[model samples]
Target chain A: MRVSLKTVLTLTTLFFISACGADDAADSMWRKLPLNNTVLLTLPHGKVVIELAPQFSPKNTAQFSKLTQQGFYDGTKFYRVIDGFVAQAGPKDGSKKDLSVPILAMEADFKVAKDWAYTPVQQQGLFAQQTGFKDGFAIAYQQGKSPNSGKAWLTHCPGTIAMARNNAADSASSHFYIVIGQAPRYLDRIMTIYGRVVHGMQHVQAIQRTAVIEGEYAVDHRDFTEIVSMQLMSDVAKAEQIHIEVENTESKAFAERLVKRRNRDSAFFYNKPPPVLDVCQIPIRSRIVK
Target chain B: MRVSLKTVLTLTTLFFISACGADDAADSMWRKLPLNNTVLLTLPHGKVVIELAPQFSPKNTAQFSKLTQQGFYDGTKFYRVIDGFVAQAGPKDGSKKDLSVPILAMEADFKVAKDWAYTPVQQQGLFAQQTGFKDGFAIAYQQGKSPNSGKAWLTHCPGTIAMARNNAADSASSHFYIVIGQAPRYLDRIMTIYGRVVHGMQHVQAIQRTAVIEGEYAVDHRDFTEIVSMQLMSDVAKAEQIHIEVENTESKAFAERLVKRRNRDSAFFYNKPPPVLDVCQIPIRSRIVK
Candidate 1:
């Protein structure tokens, strides 16, 4: 989600103003809470909306908060666009010298055995607190490892938001990227992932692709889809009215749907795939009822 | 690789005239070969130089031949533009009326143990028979069950030409799609594999993406990247001089590169991945050496 710092500030102010109430306080708080917070990303062609998934990736949400509070991603553009691969974005500082705020590298959430064992068998509507989100921010959790080893991270699936790194490990600060094609799992732990473009991905994907720039071989020159403005829905009075829900992962209906796609037992398949599902391949769509 | 048909026709004519040796009596026979041996596809965004891969898929090639000869794809436009999936083109005849050509659905290419294996154990490259060039078309054997079992076909890797089919068994014709991202393996045998894009895939990818049209849910509008024209590079004077070479699949260098990528032993990889390589995940980079 391409957010402008102005919107973040507006939401902060609104949050404080609404908190000043009493009699209708609880109701007002719930009503003012962000619901189907949608961000409209304007591209050279058109716009696409991304609904954030906050339940899954709280850390990612927190990082997004920090970055926006500092106005870190305000003027940045998508700099890398590799066909069939990904489109990356980040701070304009190629040398890490221009960072406006303090930056840090995030840890990895590799799906190792112990990690997998600790990963609760996914349940419908039951939030899995590692690298998952309500919108498009990167996320992770503390599940298994040593006492301090239960850590999670944002994944590099399509539409993911990650920080760009230099040769050194802690080089990532204000840069980021969005996966536009096949999942680039190769970049799993090398960079810091913060969020993703949950709503305006089509707008991000439709940017005019160009040859790689000279100095930054990994970056592209296509003008990024413009950001009219991105704000937290909690800042707006109408935020309370919008509600959206994701299909419960552990539900029977969702299980059947996944089974059909993963195995293709339908007459259509002459050969069935192995009973394995790549977490990234699963689709998480959001919609509003009434 | 977007070819300007007009330019190619001019180049083909000039080359044909020049290639006719004055000393050979057979030159007279060759001179009679019509310049109409090529087909030009004009798109709005840019040009795509498609040398129909007929020899790779004789039946499908013949189908294309019949369609092009009849100017079936003349006014048609690219319809589908999935950001990371594919960009579909061909006759937008949603009725599936293009299936009039006589080629039945063939089994998937899993029969040939050595040639069709997806596991990394088997070697892979552009070495399928019934494989040859039709004019400038790069084609392979079109495999059928009965008399056509051993036949070859054009692999649908990227920049492929294919017949669009519905859920039915043998429905495909008119509508075709060019893969703009990773190869869509699921559609392999379900539709007839025909040819590939020889050049100008960027032009195809640059086409604007839009919501599927009203009646034809599969097709987008004609707001495609403009194609200056599409003609064979072979027909141009310096086309032969433009020397290029694909990495030999049997070479030790190719195997070593694959192994390195599969394991990610490079400094770039901080962790080790499972030693598995999906066939379609490989990268094939092309360059103009000379």
Candidate 2:
């Protein structure tokens, strides 16, 4: 809307998003990810850190980890980048068979168990009965936690990293994609999600987009975004490493944060929307800690 | 997914999205827009055609047309652009007072009349009981056609053009914004949506964005995208004119099209999603006609 700089300015002043109250970001409320499982993917523009969701898709993340450790992803180019769809990267097309690594079985979704835990966004979705967060990952699942009563899978939210495959359900290899636009809920259980970008998403957004003519397979050979390297965080020198901490989704403070956002007490929202929020729309806080 | 070029190629082969079955795109199924109410907004890269929704917000569109005729939008810079939010432009900050145009009273929403017309998506939305397309524009509204039973408003879908305003309910003068990313349904009845971009959304996506710090009003001056001109189609020279025809949302052909897309009966979709589509996600067909 016109004169919205003032509005956005007001929002910025009211909520210092980056500097969330020091208490909220305190050590106890935030959880550190396992360095060995985390990836530091360096693009030409900047570095993007991806936290692998091994618990959800062990096979996919394992194969990705193996590929990264072997330097298979170094010099890989983001060959397919649709502005509002996905940014995919890996060895060139048809080259996966040449590598010694075996194609991993798809872990696109799993049956919800009795002990299945998640920070519920508690909103009904077009694709799933319930949508929410699990260990800091956006996900959708069938309602009811009764063992094997429902299925659960990571959602295709922006910055999501999922394994790419062909017609065959389990035909995925090292090639993967990052969700770059609106949440494509249709691909939820069909594609396996391995990880998510926890930092430097702006650089990922800045990735040079390839020309895509809607349904046409028009591949123009131009300067594509290249992957300089993909390394495990633990491998980097201590001084050069950038440690990260994500807000514990299950924490009381995080729940309060969600409630506060759901209830927009701001005068600007004269016509307040329903208390429910879209799972994919909520921003889960993450930060780089010294 | 990997080998997706082949997948996308298959989809292109199966369904030419642009070249829908000739019968589906026939004149009977397509509705022509009034030339005088249509606008051709030219940018540095290309042109974006916008069709004004005068029925919904007459005052707002009238003011915009008057401003366009006065050459008010030419050479304006998209001074504030958030990648996943909005691309705004006009006479710059604190410049609305310099214009002679009066602030149009807000027409953000209206109560549904007995004859309230819409091509019902028949899908529930996060913000309303129903969401759908009305005269080719995405919208959300309270359910029921009974006169004055509920409210309806244009949604903030990608490519939507809405008037920007401050705290005052009717303070919008000239500056406006275009939704560029995920549909922020939360803004439904808060801002006046007078028009929508029917064509050249890609060019708008290619606009240069300003750097923004999360929740911080740190504006770094960069090569901001500029507006060359915005003119009503009727005022354009005959040779330069590009006539547009949109698929009649109320037509049976359009309803069938929606069903086909909603069903997604493809081999790629091993597990189909619910037989429902998000109102903001549906692509209303528009074509250039001689």
Candidate 3:
């Protein structure tokens, strides 16, 4: 069941060029723009393409680089899989035995605007600015108080990569999880979030619950299943290039799309819901846009 | 191993009593004054304590009662368990070749006021009403539009009991699901939602994924886990004696608590977030405050 990075790239490339057409093909050239900052998150089902937001947390991004280089996460398993909340993974090195090393903390991501509904831009498949990379970090911004003093932070949107922490102020380290549900900003400033999964999140979503040890409740045992190994997409073959086009965060099509979905203008819905969109509710679709 | 309903009710009583205390106990008593309309929800882990929201959806509630009387969902198993999205169940009979009846549609729950939030009315363990049940239907009153005119749909907070349907509206008949994570409003108007899980939701959450088919993802003919059976809490012992108290929807404590949590004055949070609480984001805590 293990999928190789090379195979994925090839399938992705074929999917994009053949399905997305030529104009998109020309725009897809942006992929060639040096992905040195890219990090390949290998999950059991597929790989997560992460564009590190270094600008948001310079130190954290550097740490991530060092950790990836050192292969710290190479063998970690995805330990927690909450249907829609998150899929937690990393050293599953039992916290009880590993509390000695203090967890690290990072600052919040940059903000874009407060109460900003959404403004579409030139991109085709991108969402909010939080949809893209900031150096190595992926984030979203919202105006809080003054129009100019809007703040930015890591959104708990699906596929978000975040550092795990204990119940302390500045506690979070390599242990991470991807948001699989509604954004849990309740954990916002309390935890240090670092990156986001740009592609292949479905693979993580479809992983079967393995090595489950029944406790008082069915909490995943750290020792149950281990992440066999991991590799980066950049190092994979050309045929395996995954042509992903995010919903342009700043595109007019995007905003209208949100409004459309919220109201469900499609024939599918008989009732119209009050128009509102939670940050996490926004979907960032990835198709083969080679 | 599947736990018994009696043990579950006993354990939950302990859980609630331990999780709450004193002056709060008395006030909760006030809020729980008259127990006219009640509903029972059974799960694998144990029996959940729930009261129907007769006010939100009278038609839906009536349909649910009619279906229950016919034992439509008695032997059904929970088919889907998305950690933070929902734990779905209902008529396992639908896909069975022996059965042909379709799912039924239910009306939406009422909306809550924007100004009101669920908080401790008398004690920390008890949360005030973010939404309340009227005539056995889940309803809320938020700030904005008319107190009654504002969109009032089922609050998809955790433990919400809803009916499942096909692509067409009004298709729901026997299938149902429970909210296990943050509310998924995307499914709001699209589906026939009925009631909220009054109790035993944890049991629903704890069910082990078994040999049932994963629909589109089933590898071969391999089966996924299926629910052995489902019973109403009223059918179990101790479930009758279960004293449940909901937070008063019209309480000032609910408003303040929402603001406090939204802002996070506690040291645990280093950054305070915007004070906007979505209708679904409000937490409504229930306890056996006898």
Candidate 4:
């Protein structure tokens, strides 16, 4: 509860650096995710994790790991959020469980390997001509010279998760969605995102929206938000897991935190900005381990 | 409760127009806002409006209409929201106002008028080298030719709003905030934006977020988000007015909504995109005229 611009209000007076209780103690500028393609979910207030990207949507991360190991996204009910845009969940109409899983195939973009541990970040991207970071998500590519050019997907940014298809680009299965605002860029290469919450994006920005403008009040069914289960962090139980890590956005201290987030040699800035860096306002960090 | 991706899921299955119960009846693509430079705010979950850019932060929208006409942002509380980023509110420390009102004057970049009504919308902008829309906010300019060669600011997209100074570029008096996610193009030209929440950006994305993380819970004070009063929609009361409108971003139906959002010739897109648009994902329609 501080702001007289003294204890950090916002719209800048420079307050960047609260990757919560920080002190990375260099685990080599962070790493971990991909324990059999992570995931945690759980919500009624917290526990989101996620990760996935199985090398860029392998059959939608193997049908979201066979629908969260068949607990099928537990109680599923973020029934279509859409505040800054998107929260969605499962079975909203996609109807429940099993049926030999099927329906997927549009990894939207993929096929990277011409040396793809990519880490660029933005060289003019409002619709990619370059934008970056790979493993921890947010991407864009196709800078050809023979990698069969133009591939690489995932870029909806804000905690992206993707999958919930319809106009038939192979209509995704177990319904999905997450983004939560700002980086829509018209669903770039059209959604197949696969995963990325890497630790509760504030429980996915505290989902619950389902749109309601004027004097509000219309989202009921006990106002949704459910999904109280979903595991697979290699099946959680090691005294109740939850380690997470992240930040090695191809480290060198994340290219010095992307050149201190693209130039702000800080003096609380006196009109400087123009080295440019809005890879969705870069904040890679992600922590939580004790 | 549909997601079987039939009734529009997100990440595109096209849910484009639902500017809520639409049907504008051609009031010529909307207009209004500027009733003594609008504002409304209120909050136990409804009413926001805002709209003040007195031609781009004129003395912080006249010190936010003289501290929202003296009630000084009623009950103040959104004490720092920061989920996708930013919600802030006044006096979390800026104290109970009126130190003879004065504390503005940065207006972070203005001086347009090389035939101003701008409108363009994007030519590669991740930190503007062209991005547009003028009277309905989201801007960026300067394309030099001697009118002092560089100015035109307002843009931190998402429901913007600004003002909350500290490191002294004319300290900005009563704290404010609002951009609520994604467009923190590093606080564009660094803060002084003034207003825009035109129509309760879903009650400012339902504020109440002050950082939490592990199984959440740390934003107590009855979990903040209070500000329940604020007026000056020319001092309300014409049977509770709220006719807003807005969508004349140099009309011709907003240049056919920026050419159908820069070529998304719907067939619900079958791998098309790359005609770029992201002027904060272009949606400019706003409404509520009854």
Of the candidates shown, which would achieve the greatest DockQ relative to the real structure? 2
Q: What is the lDDT of residue A227 in candidate 1?
A: 39
- Model 4, residue A227: distance off in Å is 4.5
Docking class for model 1 is incorrect
Summarize candidate 4's per-residue lDDT along A148-213 as a digit string, tens digits: 565677788888888877787887777888887777757777778888787767667767777665
**Number of the candidate with higher TM-score, 3 or 4:** 3
> For residues A23-60, what per-residue lDDT tens digits would candidate 3 score against the true structure?
33233322321354666666554555665666566767
Against the unseen true structure, what C-alpha lDDT does each candidate score? 0.45, 0.74, 0.49, 0.70
Cα RMSD to native, each candidate? 14.6, 8.1, 12.3, 23.6
lDDT of 2 by residue, B248-284 (tens): 8766677667657766888888876665566767767
lDDT digits (tens) for residues B1-290 of candidate 4 = 01122211221211123121123422256677767788888899777887888877777788788788888889878878877778888765634453545677687887665545455665435466666776678788756667656667877888888887887688878778888778876678778887778776766776777776544347787778899888888888888878677776654566556766666788767876666666776766676766
Candidate 3 DockQ, CA atoms? 0.12
**Pick by lDDT: 1 or 4, better one:** 4
Error of model 4, residue A247, in angstroms? 34
On TM-score, the leading prediction is 2
Comparing 2 with 4 on lDDT, the higher-scoring candidate is 2
